[model samples]
Target: MRSVLVTGGAGFIGANLVLELQNRYPDAWIVVVDDFRSGHFSNLEGFRGDCIASNVAELRLSERFRDGTFDAIFHLASITDTTDHDQLRQVRDNVESFRMLLNWASRDQTPVVYASSAATYGKAQSVMTEATDASPQNVYAFSKVQLDNLARYYHQQHPAWKIVGLRYFNVYGPREAHKGHASSMIFQLFQQMAAGKRPRIFTDGEQRRDFVYVKDVVAATLAALMAPDSRIYNIGSGASASFNQIVAGLNKALGTQLEPDYFENPYPFYQNFTEADISLARKELEYQPAFDLDRGIHDYVDWLQKERSS
Candidate 1:
């Protein structure tokens, strides 16, 4: 059986990717490592694997991975709360864990595919390309930026091994309810409407994002695993959608007419607009996002309603 290690395998995106990998590689032996700091074990319900309950920071390379060789390492473990005020903890938990991964990769020469964030771009201009200057507005984003830079440095030092970084934009889909405040606007709006309440949004709900679905993100990441070259690729729908659009999409999908309660956004730093220049991802990873905002929200709400009913 093919062996693969998925860090953060109990989290939102990681759980989805694990299911996909199981479907793609039916006989593969998957090792899931999750500390459950943010991820929920319910996310891994019915999953069949040897799950190691440990943090990447506290892992021993000789003892943990000495017996087996993995085809790829999906490094999704990190402190992703963008509103976190603790910068030192962000570095200690996120950057330090990534350093451990880099150390293992350096010795094992395994392909390391990590989850980078479009948060690295901050409130900069939209339609950002890979070459665009990164202006991280939060500690979490800064941590990701540090990891991306470190990935590049590792790639340079170990050119023979493939280390891919995917800069994901605003993503939403199934299995994200555990994220709570960190969940996507699409999910949050559906919750409000499902509860027969108005959706709460920031300002006029005009803040836009390149809301790519989870399916697309996983597909793109899978493609990147087979990519001939290693580098950072922007994983997002090359289009932007306003929060108002998400509200509308949810209402339409849920068969309810609900208006959004727009309040003043109090955050000092907010990303008002984000649209990825996905030309690089398309050319390199052969990745094309399958879901736009309207369709993605519709599908998500449909599944969510069924889940709730079941």
Candidate 2:
């Protein structure tokens, strides 16, 4: 824990993790690596670490990470946009960049905790677990699945290194202002409400999603440093909340009772429901989600209002 690396450290979850890392390990020499593809430098307004503004694939080219430089690496950089259409770029950037980082980690024998996704579960509605079959429906999800597969291959090749992957569910919270259209529905709804507009929803807004707050996601991610083993685990609330509930929560938080305007969902490949079965994560990582939908919404709205003022 003396030296840590957080790729995509300016992203929503990574930025929050950076803050938490500083708070927890005051003496750790933290380094943030990002290409600014979707991450915002403003997100690291108070970050104290060194930054390498490059893709993980270019880490070696940039001549960083010589050897035993990073005690642990939080690999959150990837093609996170689920709607990305370029299949080749998605695989190249997400999977190849990760392969580069995995090679670096293997060479250094450093522990790595990387970001996986719920997208691997695709249309599966049953409780999501580590054992669930991967059914990726898009190129982005496919890239994540490939990353997981690569990690498994490398883990078998290098048995002693800790290479854990966290399959994050619908994470939403602070430092996500730059996600734009890719931001979560919670942030999108809050923005519409703050702008004195009705929240927009597709259809009946009954489609459920397990929206785990960014704080909880960061905690679960960091827990892998002390986790029992290096394996993929779901980091989520283990509870599903509908879009209707999200609108309701926002209304209560913003003190604006605005009914949602229903519209048809444009995308054909949409997950109707997702609820993570976090029992194994709970037992293994000792990770528990503290912010329910309502609580997380409250915290998010508070930050939103402050952002407006600042």
Candidate 3:
């Protein structure tokens, strides 16, 4: 691959993927397209690639680059905030932006590995799989469902194009601080414990989530580029960890014991549990998670401390 494009390059997962791309493909000419809506420039501090501050829907791909310029595209841009209730804005930004990218990429038949979400499972507690129908409790998840729909439609239209969508589970790791309230529970809990305050959790703190590290998410995403056909796969740790366990992990990582302040969950649409069935991704992409909850927590905490001192 000579040229590469990452849409949400300054975002949490996007930033991690961008840095990895630089390390693995030193000679590749990389370009980033981001509007900074939910992304941060600090996340791309060490990135040695060109960045275009523009939305995917508004960016004129043809004017900037001719056909076949981008060897591969990693599309991660979207309205990531799950709590935001603006249905029109969420659907428009997330869905239309993907539509524009697909229309442009069709010219060269460029391979696109885009971000999907585990939230599509809604309240379903069963292990998430690609074949399961999307329930989409929120507009953000609804928009992602639309993106997958678009992927399917475009795949049928252009049979040879490689379009892979990765249904990312609760991804948590470095470069996610900018997400604020939408950031993972692990990061939020770590912050609270580091500050000598009790971590807060909903109710009894038994709600479990499949917290896959961002590094693993990036690995599965990059592997999708070589997929033989257009399809979607679930990317996760294949195990669910309860909120109570998260507090325990944070306590161990920070070397400070802090009990969680339990409160009732205000959101009715909240998912009580999520665990991905990653067997398909393992068989198809040959992807394996290198970090589990404890390892990921320690690594992320160390990174956070380093960033604080730096």
Tens-place lDDT digits, model 3, residues 1-310: 7889999999999999999999999999899999999999999988899999999988888887764478899999998999988999999889989999999899988899999999988998688788888999989999999999999999999999999999999999999999999999998888888889999999999999999999999899999986779989999999999999999988998888788999999999999999999998899899899999999999999999999899
Model 1: number of backbone collisions? 0
lDDT of 1 by residue, 138-222 (tens): 8898999999989988888888989999999998998989889888878887888899999999988988999999999999988
lDDT of 2 by residue, 1-310 (tens): 7999999998888999999999999999999989999999999987888998998876683256544478888999987888988999899989988888887667677788999999999999688888999999999999999989998999889888789999999999998879989899899999998898999999999999999999999889888888766699999999999999999999999899999999999999999999999988899889988999999999989988888898
Model 1: residue 266 alpha-carbon error in angstroms:
1.7
What are the candidates' C-alpha RMSDs? Answer: 1.0, 1.2, 0.9
> In model 3, which runs have C-alpha deviations exceeding 4 angstroms?
none
Model 1: how far residue 276 lies from native, Å: 0.6
Task: List, in order, the clash count of every candidate structure.
Answer: 0, 0, 0
Error of 1 at 40 (Å): 0.6
lDDT-best of 2 and 3: 3
Between candidates 1 and 3, the TM-score winner: 3
Off by over 4 Å in 2: none
Ranked by TM-score, the better of candidates 2 and 3 is 3
* Model 2 weakest 10-residue run by lDDT: 59-68
Best by the lDDT measure: 3
For each candidate in turn, the TM-score is 0.98, 0.97, 0.98
Instruction: List per-prediction Cα lDDT, in the order shown.
Output: 0.88, 0.89, 0.92
